[model samples]
Target: MRMHEHPTINYPEYHWPAGKRCAVVFSLDLDAESPFLWLHRGQQVQQLGEIEQRRFGPRQGLARVVRLFAEYGIRGSFYVPGVVAQTYPGLLPFLLEGGHEIAHHGYYHERIEAIPVAQAEDYLVMAQELFCTQTGLSGLGHRAPSWEMTSDFLQTLERRGVSYDSSLMGFDHPYHVGNMVEVPVQWTVDDALYFRYTNSPRDKTHPANPGAVLDSWIEEFEGVRETGGLFMVTLHDWISGRSQRLRLLRKLIAHIRHDPQVWWARADEVAAWHAASPNRDLYRVPAHSINTHFESATRG
Candidate 1:
């Protein structure tokens, strides 16, 4: 398959001059299925498993990820499911106290694209309220469950006061989705897709050698840095928390710290800068790119 290209935006009125060459946005998607698995079994089964449930349960993997982020002094955006927050209120406080941005993932880890607009909107509202009540912080950002989103879904996010989203892949920088900004996260760097897609009788799901994954990511990060572009890595707590995968994460972080150009930042902060900096012009996408779906969806 041909590589995907980023989208281009023409906003002369609001466009700012380019600022930094690249900004790195690390996002942790915190959606797991359990207790409420029966609510959306068909959809949830593809992305999670019972063993994953036991590993990623509140006390096991999630907390470890929280501590890792804190240790790195890197504040990341956590796209959390509302049900997860409700079940583990203490986790919400811990994330807030440690200074991370919380974004809406979904109410129960269900794919919003499969549901009707009215139903999706209701779920989004419930998720926003649940997150705010449990974490004492209102979320203005969203990432769809399983990175599965549609034009209607994006419209819903705009109408519901979500400031940005990070579900789409194939971009090295952030761009606007209608009036809301889209902090594009390259799913190629995402562990979930890498592991899940590679799972076959002939191919192992997890990387045969974790170092190879780290090496690939580091090479991408270095190239982005060379061009003064952003490097965003997406991962799920359930997958990356595994012994082998966790080591890859450590190695990747170490490589980033060793680099002089890398600026480890929260997704929200990257959005803020992209909105404020004149250098926003630096994030241009080729006109013929398929990733221009955001622009096409809104224009239609």
Candidate 2:
């Protein structure tokens, strides 16, 4: 049979709650060293320095991030992989105690679509279960490890009662995938593409110019503010927490915070607000980009 073609995705206008002009979500993927392990698989042990670099997030960078957020009174959202949460036991307690939101990231930081459907489901289940076991409640949101997404995996999330997901860039605003909302994310807002560098052959990213990143993010803020859209800024403990990158992040935050119309919220809060609205499925965006094609093929 010829490959099935999904209908052209429609771009619909979506609004934020509370009369806010822009909903800004500081979503952190606390992948730590797990991403390197997931990306390299069996070769992770060979990339010792990369592992150490990744560890910098939880080891020292996390404190700095925490301090900055406290200074700004921002209750940021953190997506913690279960392995990382288990590896660093004190991390989640401090985050929760500080009024931060801890969301589910995979268990082993596995790429959701790269693994089998059962494995992907297992990763999410383990992550969610561990989060519940650790915090005595469920995490309301999920940002798939490396922002991976698949239709089947999305179905899993909906079936398992996830309120929202942040792994897909389906639109400039949140849209429903069945009952579960997708709080969209884009690479332009992700810190890993702009930061994260190492000497290892497996290390492919280059250090982005801080000034350029700040300008781009600020520009994005302005554009999103106009639409009253959700500005889902994706950061990683290991990348954006670096001192130099952290400085850039500070500037970006300051710039966005300067606008009184910007609503600083956690990922789960944004998701929950969107979920509570009956208009969640009110808009739809085209998900058939080149990336979606690759994703569809991969899922097959």
Candidate 3:
């Protein structure tokens, strides 16, 4: 199908009721390092063949994240890697019990853009089945690991019962990608920023300084709210599971909870709202060569 042939996706435009400003969606990436790193490096592959660190794994971190979300009375999406789900069967039930949504993050956490098209399709299918079987809930959302999704990957998701994908960045609101609505923008407020700022290199095992990250995020949130847009915060089990990070998350949640206009919701809930509401053309800019400052603040 051609790029613009798909139906336009319409999202809701609910005003803050008087004092409200913006909506927030928190998404967690549940991934295991062994298979994920192995697929990329032979050294990690050999190391994984020797060690078994299943106990202090993705599920453990997920449990912590879920607990934190429950404390805030908020529901978010948990995008799990298939390998992680198979390794930890108890994780899915805990998420379901907490009323969180389970989304697919791909099988084995392989980079779909690097793999062959047929192989990528197989990986996506495997992920969907493993997530459904273990969780007893079929996932409707997809997020490519490492934020690496090509056009082919998007097409594969459209074919695999995926209703939305949250891998795209630089868009302020959700938009249709072919026949699927993409929950665009990830890495807006992530632990990776700490690593980048510290020049610590990208290591998921490293802990994130949550207070500093949250402070920066709050600033971004205020900016988006003033402009009437969506704020997407991406967290990873391995990174945000630390005590310091969790504490920062709680503080951020407290601020969001006090605001009546700020809707703290799940990705699916936001998608459903968009589908049911009228299209307001929220992200369109009036002129060519849009200024980066305005685009950065309002683009989904």
Candidate 4:
């Protein structure tokens, strides 16, 4: 009897530019009042508590975050919603002026599952139009609002010519989702999960300590460095812009700088490098389901 032969599984190694051991992307979701407005759409939001708290990002938090990045000479990426850019006309200009990359987030931090694919594409078009009108540039990167991505959403991204997306958590480094380059993000490293608080019963756990969060992030960075993967930190301006959190971030950046082998880059930079490198075809995932075996697999 002859045995079946299985092909060898290929695990491709990610090679960072300049031969760095790892890549680091300090990304921020520059969501100001867009999330609040989205949540209260079609109704009167008489309460100012959440609105004011979210507004802090635009009025003060963003400036603080930008200043810190400037101090560290880090060109971080800012994912902005169309509503945010429209509400604050100077936002795009300010980010570009700071030598940072402005990527598309959504029209209103929309929940992709609630809207149709056409609506989602329309949101992307609106965001693209806003970016071009304000900054005379096209968006090369996108990170879905709330980190939600469906097959339709990913297809919409491809149709709109978005070069890359940062919402998926498939791989620590860059990979391909259909035709779109994916710069993965982890919830554990996202600032909102640790710092976001609304003063409501929905709050299950208190915000984590800033020092502890910094230590965890540093440990994650070290671990990713050892694996030669990407350490993509997702921060929210409203959450991480506080004085204490900013200090934590500053300390973390200082610690990261101590290692010169990390490729500190923006999301677009990593995506572009990945798309152009041999890794483009090595790590691939389908954007949509290719088979319908889930029902059978889960049936009792």
Candidate 5:
């Protein structure tokens, strides 16, 4: 199909709960040391510096974040890898006590693209079970580590009774991806793009200044507000829980709170509202349809 000939659908005006004009979700990837452990699963962990850096997330960073949330009197979402929770033991209870939403990240913060689809599904099942076992919370939401997803993985989410998946970036607002409520994410607003700085040679650039990143995030928030979209800020505990970054977060929260029309919500709350609202089917974009379109466009 030609560019203009491609199929199109009319997306109704997205709505926020409580007559809010726009939505903002504060979500944290409480990754801790799971990602580093995943990268060196079998080999001996020689990168002690990086591992210790990530460990700071659970040891000190998360506590600082919890204090900040308490100060703001707002609840946020915390997506935890199974390994991190298991290692910390008290992590889930602490988050629950803080009135935060706990969602599934991965078993070990494994990248779905690097493993077989079956293995990835197994990890999902394992993580879900672990979360349920520890917190007694079922039907939790998921956000793929590294923001990666596949058709089979999406299907697994549906079969597992997942309330929503916040990995895809199809739209700034929540939409369906094959019957799953997709709470879209963008790298521009995610902290890893700006704050993830390991001393590894693979690092091509230095970490950005916290002030500059806060300015860019505020600019993006303004744009999203103007467009009446979701401003989902993804932060990692290790990367964004530092003192300077936390100050930036406080400023951002203060600025957002100034706007009375904004809806500050957790990820699952936004997903629930979208699932029940008129916008549910209005913005549906199933993954299979996109695969078919790509195949047709690239035909020999």
Candidate 6:
């Protein structure tokens, strides 16, 4: 395998608004089987275990997670699919009540890279409209369904007036995906890799132990503190909402709270600060580079 040339985002010299040591962005994704549904449309009836596991999110996990945030008095960026917002009406309202940042996570969790451009446009447009209609708030951030970023997708976000995205793995700090700011995410800081399973024979899931995940994330935070880079954590309600894993998340937050220098921010605030950054241009991906990088990733 090969690697694409990563973004040359210079986080070392950039000054944070709070002057904190490093930034920690905790974003929770409420995909809730929408991606599975999109992938298995015709056979949706047969995937009972998948359906119930995902259903566990909205049914019990959401409120638990919301209350956990309240206990800590810190807000998370909640990215929900448009269909999810519609499917579970109370979930959005609860998030809004907690003063969390609500952002777009594709309408049905469809992979924009695999769909036609027009189809992708319609899916995003309807999702944006429907979510706004439901909540009366428009999204300022977007996280691609499968962490798949492309030129067309970035353009779509730019045209929609979205200020930032949290889908790419290019850089840890907030940087540009075209004119749109990207808050990078990594597999290491995510719980799904450790927890999610689909009963597939080839899928090698991580251990059921939550301490391993907790310990690894702390290491990441401490290491990023050196450069004062942003530490973006991607979590799923369905996977991380279980009792033990939720405890893991709580401990993670508690551990971070121990550090007085860590800046706790939502993704939008990070984007706003980065947008005003004098070194902003250093991270901007030129028009042609998006396609070039995507091609390289595909080939590699």
RMSD to true structure for each model, in Å:
6.5, 4.8, 7.4, 3.7, 2.6, 4.1
Runs of candidate 3 exceeding 4 Å displacement: 1-20, 34-36, 39-59, 195-209, 280-300
Q: Per-residue lDDT for 1-300 in model 6, tens only?
A: 223345454345656775688888888999987977887777736648777889888888877887888898888898899889888877777888898999999888988889887888888888888877778877558888878867787888888877788888766677776678888888888878788876766468645678877888899989888877888888888887889888998998999988888888888888888888774876766533523333334543
- Which runs of model 4 end up more than 4 angstroms from their true locations? 1-10, 290-300
| lDDT agreement of model 5 with the native | 0.89
Between prediction 4 and prediction 5, the one with superior TM-score is: 5
lDDT of 2 by residue, 19-110 (tens): 67778888788889887777777662653777898899999888888888898889998888889998998888889998998888888888
Where is the poorest 10-residue window by lDDT in model 4? 1-10
**lDDT by residue (tens digit), candidate 1, 1-300:** 334554344434323223344677778887655323735466645654454554463656667776777777878788878777777777677777888888888887778767898988998899888877775566468888878777677778888878778777535567665555778877668877665332335445545466677878888887887766678888777767666776787778777876555667888877787777764555444423344334323543
Answer with 1 or 4, whichever has the higher TM-score: 4
Between candidates 1 and 2, the TM-score winner: 2
lDDT over C-alpha atoms for residue 69 of model 1: 72
- Full ranking by lDDT: 5, 4, 6, 2, 1, 3
| Model 5 regions lying over 4 Å from their true place | 2-6, 290-300
Summing lDDT over every window of 10 consecutive residues in candidate 1, give the lowest-scoring window.
11-20
lDDT, candidate 4, 1-300, per-residue tens:
112122335577888888899998899999988887898799976888878998899999999999999999999999999999999999989999988999999999998888988888888999999889988897468999999989888888888888889898878899988888999999878999889998867789998888888889989999999999999988888888889899989999999988989888988889889989888888887777444434434546
For model 2, the run of ten residues with the poorest summed lDDT: 286-295
Error of 6 at 108 (Å): 0.9
Using TM-score, give the best candidate's number: 5
Q: Which segments of candidate 1 are over 4 A away from where they belong?
A: 1-19, 34-57, 196-207, 279-300
- Candidate 2 global CA lDDT score: 0.79
Candidate 5 local lDDT, 1-300, one digit each (tens) = 433322666566788888888999999999998888898899976658998999899999989988998999889999999888888889999999999999999889999878998898888888888888888989999999988988888898899888999999978899998799999999999989987888888788998988899899999999999889999999889988899889999999999998998998999999999999989978877566533334345647
Stretches off by above 4 angstroms in model 6 are 1-12, 290-300
TM-score of each: 0.79, 0.88, 0.78, 0.93, 0.94, 0.90
